[model samples]
Target: MSHTDPDRYVTRLFRDDYPILQGLVASGRLRRAAVSLPGWDKATVFEPLVPVSAHGDHHLRLGYADLGAQIYALPSAPYAAVLRASGDYRQPAGIAGLQVCFGAPDLDAATFRAELRASLAQPLKLDSTPHLATADHGGCHATWWPNRTLILESGGDWFLALAFNLETRVIRSPGKSVFGIDLNADPALCIADSAGVARMIGPRHALLDGLRREHLDRPLAPKEVRVVRALGYASGRGPLEVALRDMLSRAEAVGVEKLDTRQLYARFVERSREQAALDWHVSWLPQALYRARIRLHRVDPAFSTQACHRHPSHLGIVRGRMFDCPLCTELQHRDKNAARNIQARTLAVHRHPR
Candidate 1:
């Protein structure tokens, strides 16, 4: 379903007044536990919440709806007792609180609640938390911690949970942003900025097109030759001459197995020479073309690094290399910069009117 429905979406928030609830249960200090649902005012209790199957283990097995159930059952006991019972199971207590937000357009709340209840009834194992953060700029679902926050476009439909130290209400932030250059496809270079923004550059074809357009009336240079060579290597093709020579060698190799020694040798030699010429042409042609484009356009290499655009001086430093602007205090997005730059340029142009 489309990502525009609120009913298809759910967000759950969990908080606690303590830390390491699981350890407490394991040590036998906490006997039972329960949780409250988002709209509920009370907690449901689980008397003797520790399951028979959870013997000798400490954890909690509460789910989104179970939290509500615990609250609904809370009138029978004190709130603390309910919490103790809910957390009595062998499930890892690492999840101090959980927020379950769903974006399923066809979701049936009753069915979903039932599913949640069933899941909670089973023993729970501690697992890694998925990155899902909501902020004013946009939302992201992190697959891995640190810098790999995949920009999530839910169209408004999604589910998420948060875990943290119960006492402080603070989630341990994954310390650093992970940055890498993804160059396997389309030759685009990507960098995860320090502020959690990713920037990409160099789809060679597009860059080439831009270069050509930008430099339609200029003389090519020797430096341009180097850039073109670099582009050719990036595209996995060195030169036309080299490629032709390689093809000729392959054809001759196939002929050698036919037992026609004289014909094979003649073809092989002819093909080898042709292939060498092709390889030479391939190597130089792209370089020449690239040089011409650059000389004509005066294009500079595009830089893709993580940095806060707000403060361009604050570059992002990773592995002893300066990758992003350090001065920007906030996370900067790659796409946002294009808009920002455009606006800045527009304003400047209007102000100066050159």
Candidate 2:
């Protein structure tokens, strides 16, 4: 078991699959998938990676034993991208390669390493936990599991890591039924359930949800909103994380299962170059949900908006704004009703494929 090789090499990790995943997203092959959890609404697929939108320029708060630790952000593009891509996972699957080996080239190598150099830095105290300090900048700690994020030095002037998190890895589902979520740029997101109830957690409430609950802030100014949204497009905040967090927190108070919404969109649409970032959320949200121990689902997105659950009629064009069933007149929110119809269609096609 302790055998050593003169030459060692590692293959790609799941997050490495991100580029392909990103392509899948652009092609509309990937959609949010959901499997319900008992005490909460359905958890979308595991998206352990935090979208770059929320954490870009955010510091990494590190700790050792009980000594003080400091938060730092690496300036290298690949490092940031790898971290952004896998950040939400239970652990950061390590990254290793020749170009990014040892350290980021753009960074002052000595300065960057000095932070982790031990001799050059002072340790800070951790004073807050559960309830501590002010909400504005008060924070929690992140621990490292052996699950993902292991980097090493290669002998021939190279460094490499296989970045992936085992703790948050995707697994077969244990749920009985599926829930579908159809997305709209209007309200942001929607959810539909089996009992014919549709719900939504729109943008306004989502913004108020804040990065952390204890330290809520006033509404984001218009400019700030654009930046955050754009990050989701470029790096990502994995939009559903906040939405699910807000909904599940309320569901906890009511002692009801929190529902999750699966994102469904069309592949047949035109893409504007400026809107490329719009696709970032899809690749990362599931990993974020996985860290939260939630599940996400995806269904065939075609006509999810027009087709009514009560009838097979494409009753109205662009009919997803409000849920109005022409046959029985069963009214629902456009997104909510669409979610129900999506769930029905996805289940009919593949009944909980492993």
Indicate which candidate wins on TM-score.
2
Candidate 2 residue-wise lDDT, 8-94, digit = tens: 112112232334444433554433334322212322332223221112222221111111101111111222333344333221111
Q: Total clashing residue pairs per candidate?
A: 47, 39
Q: Output the number of the lDDT-best candidate.
A: 2
* Shift of residue 167 alpha carbon in model 1, Å: 30
lDDT of 1 at 318: 38
TM-score of every candidate:
0.16, 0.38
lDDT of each: 0.26, 0.33
